[model samples]
Target chain A: TQLLEQSPQFLSIQEGENLTVYCNSSSVFSSLQWYRQEPGEGPVLLVTVVTGGEVKKLKRLTFQFGDARKDSSLHITAAQTGDTGLYLCAGAKNTDKLIFGTGTRLQVFP
Target chain B: DAGITQSPRHKVTETGTPVTLRCHQTENHRYMYWYRQDPGHGLRLIHYSYGVKDTDKGEVSDGYSVSRSKTEDFLLTLESATSSQTSVYFCAISDMGQGKAYGYTFGSGTRLTVV
Candidate 1:
């Protein structure tokens, strides 16, 4: 079975600080997706990267797919309280299943 | 935020008791998935349905069973509740064809505790 691992499982920073979360795996995937989940709620999709070395930006968040499709990263610039949540990365092959990373919980204090 | 909804937002059951969780969606999406979320484990798929009455097991289907008799409803059943099964369950939907790049829309989730 394929597995995805995320680094810095928990993070806390002051508002305006920058932070980066990493997701890695030994198996290559066709695409990778990022999701943010608030307390007591299901996760919400943040972005999807399909091609190797592809980068997508959504407001203050930047997501990048690895050149080998075996890893990904999410970076937050000038983080705010709204940016605090659990961030998850999922790797998908050609099938319907997606392997999700452990997750990174971020807390941005104002 | 999709039209997906899960019933019994929270439930408590005893060991050896049977329990079922319901997931309902109004988007008419062709695919629905059931997943369990734990503290260290982000989300693990337990089962999924591609269409009405078409279902398949996922990575963590050991003690779980699923039935999809209709397009909008997917049911997950645990024959006998176990303490290890206590976790938050989420239902998700996607409309993309196979091999397509798309994200899933997830329901709020159900928190179950087995004692």
Candidate 2:
């Protein structure tokens, strides 16, 4: 079985602070996707990185896939209250199945 | 998400009782998956179906069964509810295979509790 391990399981920061969440695994993946989920709702797709060492930016969020395709990271710039949520990283191999990371719970306070 | 829906937003039942959860989709996506989310465990895939009457177990398929008799509905049943089974269940739909670059659209989720 493949497993994705995420770091800093819980994060609490003030508004305007920058934070980085990391997702690591010993197994390599063909593609990796990032998602952010608010309370009482399912996670929403943020971005998908298919290439090693590739970086994609979406507004204030930036996602990067490691050179080995075995890790990924999500960086938030000037996080706001609305950016507070559970961030999840999902990796897929050659099949249709997706293995999701443990998750990073972020909280931004005023 | 928009096209996917999960039934019984919240349910609480006694242990050893059978419990079933439903997932309905209108997008006509060929792939459907069931997952359970728990603190420190993120979302764990329970089962998935590639097409009607076709299904496969996921990483945490033990003690759970799934059936996909129709194109639009997928059902997950717990043979006998156990306290450890209490968790938020999510259903997701995707039109692409290998999940590729496009991620899945997930339902609000079904909160199940076993006492």
After superposition, the stretches of candidate 2 with alpha carbons farther than 4 Å from their true spots are: none
| Clashing pairs in model 1, backbone N/Cα/C closer than 3 A | none
Which residue runs does candidate 1 get wrong by more than 4 Å?
A: B97-99
Candidate 1, A42: how far from true, in Å? 0.3
- Among incorrect, acceptable, medium and high, the docking class of model 1 is medium
lDDT of each: 0.92, 0.94
Reference contacts recovered by each candidate, as fractions?
0.62, 0.84
